[model samples]
Target: MRENREIAHTFDTLADLLEIEGANPFRVRAYRNAARVVDSISQNVAMMVREGRDLSQYPGIGKDLAGKIRTVSETGTLPLLEEVEKRVPRALSELTQIEGLGPRRVKALHESLQVNSLEDLEKAVDQGRVRELPGFGARTEELVRNGLKRLRGTQGRTLIADAEETAVHLERFLSGLQGVKQVTVAGSYRRRRETVGDLDVLVTCRPGVPVGKWFTSFESVETILSQGETRSSVRLRSGLQVDLRVVPEISYGAALHYFTGSKAHNIAIRKLGMARGLRINEYGVFSGDQRIAGRTEAEVFAAVDLPFIEPELREDRGEVDAARNGRLPELIRIEDIRGDLHAHTNATDGRSGLESMVDAARERGYEYLAITDHSQAVTVAKGLDVERLRKQLQAIDRLQEQYDDIRILKGSEVDILEDGRLDLPDEILRELDITVCSVHSRFNLPEAQQTERILRAMDNPHFRILGHPSGRLLNKRDPYPMDLERIITGAVERGRFLEVNAQPDRLDLTDTACQLAKEKGAKLAISTDAHSDSGLAGIRFGIGQARRGWLEKQDVINTRPLPELLKLLRNT
Candidate 1:
């Protein structure tokens, strides 16, 4: 958002996509390498340029890229980007959304077949035209065809939380084994991309035994792609692919450092390690003579004289440096989440009853899960009216007694009507455990109007949090314009928690804005905004974005334990 590497990587990635579409391998690598550099820098690239600092001073920022970064900074738009957008369907990047289709193939199809969209790509494959391409014979074409078929009508990318679910599942499986020392997720999944491309994992085990044997034993084993003493790749029944590597315990730290990649970050660390005469790889760090790490991820990092880095911050963007300087922001953990402040039940579109949603939360290790089904204003959603609200309150009382450990918070995701007032009556609002005011319609409002609409709702003391503050749907719709800074500032001043809607389509108070909220000393509530029990899984996605912002448990409102959460919510 600020023209830093995280921001630059988008453009650089776009550059690579164009290069791939342009079919220039070397240029693609250059743009990718530069993007990685932008991602790895600890300082703001855009800010540095404004100060007249040599943009190329950063390791990955070359003279050419320095120019590109400046253009983007000055205009908030890149001309090259516009040109590429015209030549390629910006959604062609969505082809990257399809597993097994790299930019080259995407470009190839775009170039060779005029396959502009998934629809066109599917048609080409079905017609057998895709089989005619170079290196793409019958089998590869069938693979592409199957991929499209499998994903047909799927409206959104797999949420980052979904990937984390798989990661946790694998972590549990591997951790349960006899010889395993530790397991962790690595790659972009660990970085918490809104939509993960695939899952990459790193595990540490005692050496002198084959870890591949353990890989063959997982519940969803489809086929082993390749296996060596240290690394293996495989597919699962769900069509997700995973790569696993075994490292000695001592190398665990460095192996994690390497595998939990912002590849740019890994390269930087490896380069730093190289200067000290250490070579690092997935297995571990190698000294001039010996294989030192036999166990533990910490020992590997200690070998290089740095503290261990968290998986989330491993994005080569200053993490190693942050590790070196001890400047890393302590990230929020799932354990820190006290409750989900926004959820629904059968009263609306939710698949289960309120108690069942609470049960799902309890089973997933939450202290409480707020049930905020639609307020009466959302007639399409069958939102609760005064009478139904009373019944829900009774139901909450019954459940609170029955499930002693889990607190059932009465709440509603009340629609913020076009007139900028919450739909629920004041009497009803006063009875709720939590009140989340949101914009479900009129997303076309202008920036000033949108900001004003939300502020009007925030003026209500009952507006405890604002849901999906931006009203965005990834790959589907961009959020309506709003003065985010104004909303966060107002929310903080009013002692209201800003909601980070975890539903993938809406990672609303996205990392950038969430970080801004923290900078402004605002509290955040990370809610699943879940519609089903499994929907609670979106909580991890919110948490991932929170971590990316370098959020601490203290920075989040829900990190309050159940008692603390209750007092905060009820204004007690």
Candidate 2:
């Protein structure tokens, strides 16, 4: 069956092709919005189709888009996409991923230079042909060159969210099989990196289970690369390669530790074992040919005289030294989060309404939920003006009376202008319980100007948190150039907090940056920046990032009680 991601990709391609073909703007937008809506849903869309449920009940999915979803779910392809691809090269959709090449430019390139792929576009730029086109110039050619480089650099990597979806489904499938003792997805995946090249799944099962064959036979397997009694490798339909390995139960911990590693962390651990006249590998820890400790990760750590580090902290970035010195931080967990400080409603680009979002947050037992819709500067999101914001504030006031269990903080994700001014004025910002300032335009500014721009925004007394501080979109866009360390310091000096946006694609204030914030005495808020109710679940990704960054309950501002959180926001 087709996954939600597959359906979304189909619609996204259909939209891209339609736009390139100069189809109606409204038609193109419908498909684009449908893709976003489908991707945001947490439930199995294919299952819904199989069960004959009404797909149009979903936000932004009209009757027409709903039918298309059903078609893709049942057939594993979209007829419209196939129809469009025959006229417009399917590969052209990929060119739209370049920073400066939207569908119109892609169309222009195709018509003027016959550029069909990245290679063709590169050749055209090299020949100075792209710059001679009407809308293209030397700067655009440079952007294409740089974007192509970044695209190639990230070619094989998959978003962590997509990888997680595949891993979880396969893990459950294997776990349900007879005699399967354990299944753990290790490697960069287990380390919770923002993006992964592939997946490594380790398992321990009863003898003679033929787990390898079972793995190869899984429904998603598109190609069986190799198979053996204890090892197997396969490529899934989504183009992600997965390797499965079976190990003895006694060596499970050792194998997991070895596989769930950054090479540096493993090497460090091996050095520690070697210093004690012990050898450590995937099998077990040995002292002169005598097996010692390997039954559990804790046992392995005890043998090396260190505590078991969390998988997220196995990056060898001061974690080992911290472990040795007994300074290893108690990383924050999802449960520690009391509220989400960044979120949107239908008043902006969000699909859900205020009441629904409130109910979802209250159901999650949050003490507060901030409604930070986009401000006027973000015109694309239907950003709210002063009058609209005031009306929304009044609406929140009325809605607040309906639910005593959660505080709905009236807020706006105000844009930080290039010159360092907040999108919304102070009078309106002061009325808000929180202000999440962000950068939504001019991403290519030089480092000094960009740094100064944010610092100037921070000078505003009402700026509480910097939302998605780095403005990175996981495989799609690189973080704009800026000195994060200086920004962290400036945030510290101004008592402003940085945000660890929980969106799977934009876990900004990356793990490393999170650690920098923690080190520089700057606090952080791990917010979902959710656009839909289901988007609230993205908090898990942020928690993983925060854990990788060595954040504790104290380092996160929203981990506090409602009153304390309010106090912190006010003080900022």
Candidate 3:
């Protein structure tokens, strides 16, 4: 799976490099979409290849992509990736990650100034060479320099989705090894953080089991940094570090709790233990010379006189006190969601059609699904104009007649224009069952203006929900400047909902923001903003974010049944 992810990354990099090289736009999009499909699917890419399955049968996978997937599965590298890297150096591809530097700018920096690496980029900026490049000004150069500085501070962390996929792959691989008894992934990865620095895996095995050799034998292991009798560290080909610890069964629980910690949370718990006349560590909980608790995480918590706290809530953010008071939140789960309110189709930028999206949602047991394609403002998405949207509404109406179990809601993800106007006319918006408005461009607005824009947009009588309220794409870009508190407060006042967009890359209305909205008595909708059927599965990621924010089913608007949901919307 790590190899699959690595290959997907190669395709993504190739796409970026191709775009910079002035390749066909469609060709670049094919690679980008293929990367998302490869990364998001649940099936194992390697297993599919080993079983002689046709990879092209998967969505977004054509003959060329299937061949690349097969090649990576078999040989663990893609020749095309190598060929592409020869044209665009890896360091230059990395430069695109800096917020202000797109591929074209990266290419300009590379060719015009011979700035191929971050070091080279810095030197060129210092020498004022970047400012002199075509299409680049002094301000842009400064932004690039600042983006580089920010990148350096947060370089090694991997997205939670990527780390989770790798962790599952490693866990399965290790469990298949001889004498392996129990395997658990601990650390920020286990806590379900948005990003993780590395993985900490705890394992217990039969006596004298040769686990160290198995750790180094993983196909994705690029290099073994260290190997010892009880512990080993390896770096995966994806540049993710993994530490494996072989613990005794007796101490496994204690070690799991200790390793699966926010440092601050663990310190607080340790202080609690000390006050109780107990010594706690990774080994076990002790009261003098006798071991008291270490057999399970529950036991460790019992020893500290606290209820078991969920990992996502173990951030020392009132969770300790909540646990002491028996008030830990019964976190929201995927099953609690009854429907998805924000989805797209081929009528817009989405890869699938309305029927397919609804079928996927129905299969997931959703009582209803919204077909919220983009409206006119987002030209790149081929967003719907007035007549086209009317036709789509009719199409959804026709599709709804064929379905007895799942209801289809006619919706539009209408763009909130630069001046706070909706992309669609009031009559068109009024025709829809629900309207999900979002900001698409002019992301550089000042905080006051951005907040005002959103506030004014929410003031529209047709607005039902604010989509991806923060305009954030994790790792790729920071959220546009806005006063979220004011925006959320406006939502509460307007009887509107905020979205926790569950796309793996854009878990907007971040956990803290979700909590703020909840605290302010503003409802939230955990929508996938799904572009494909597979994307419908992203709701689980949204659920994770909701749980971390202390949101329960009652706090999520989509958890209501159709009748109740409709009533709530109408009343609001």
- Score every model by TM-score: 0.64, 0.98, 0.96
**Candidate 3, backbone clash total:** 0
| Candidate achieving the largest TM-score | 2
Off by over 4 Å in 1: 1-117, 120-158, 165-184, 203-231, 235-237, 246-252, 271-283, 286-295, 316-322, 358-369, 397-407, 474-476, 532-538, 561-567, 570-572
- The deviation in Å at residue 308 for candidate 1 is 1.9
Model 2 alpha-carbon drift over 4 Å, by segment: none
lDDT of each: 0.75, 0.92, 0.88
Candidate 1 collision pairs: 5-38, 40-317, 249-294, 249-295, 249-296, 250-295, 250-296, 252-297, 253-297, 265-316
lDDT of 2 by residue, 19-135 (tens): 999999999999998899889888878889999999899876878889999998888888888889999999999999988999999999998899888899989988989889997
- Residue range 13-42, candidate 3, lDDT tens digits: 888888877789999999898887777667
Clashes of each: 10, 0, 0
Ranking by lDDT: 2, 3, 1
lDDT of 1 by residue, 1-572 (tens): 14343345467657656766675667676666566555434355666767888878654468887888777666566777778777677767767656457778888888899988888888898799988999788877876765675566454345564455557668877888877877787778777877666677777677565667777567566787887877788876545688887766665666665666778867776787788898777666788767765245566677678787766666665668778888878888887887788888888866567776888889887788788888887887788888998898888888888887777888888899987889988988898888888998887678999899998888887889888888876655556889999998998888888888888767888777877898899888888888766667668778888887778899888888888888887772
Please report the TM-score between candidate 1 and the true structure: 0.64
Question: What's the lDDT of the predicted structure labeled candidate 2?
Answer: 0.92
Candidate number with the higher lDDT (1 or 2):
2
- Model 1: which ten-residue window has the lowest total lDDT? 1-10
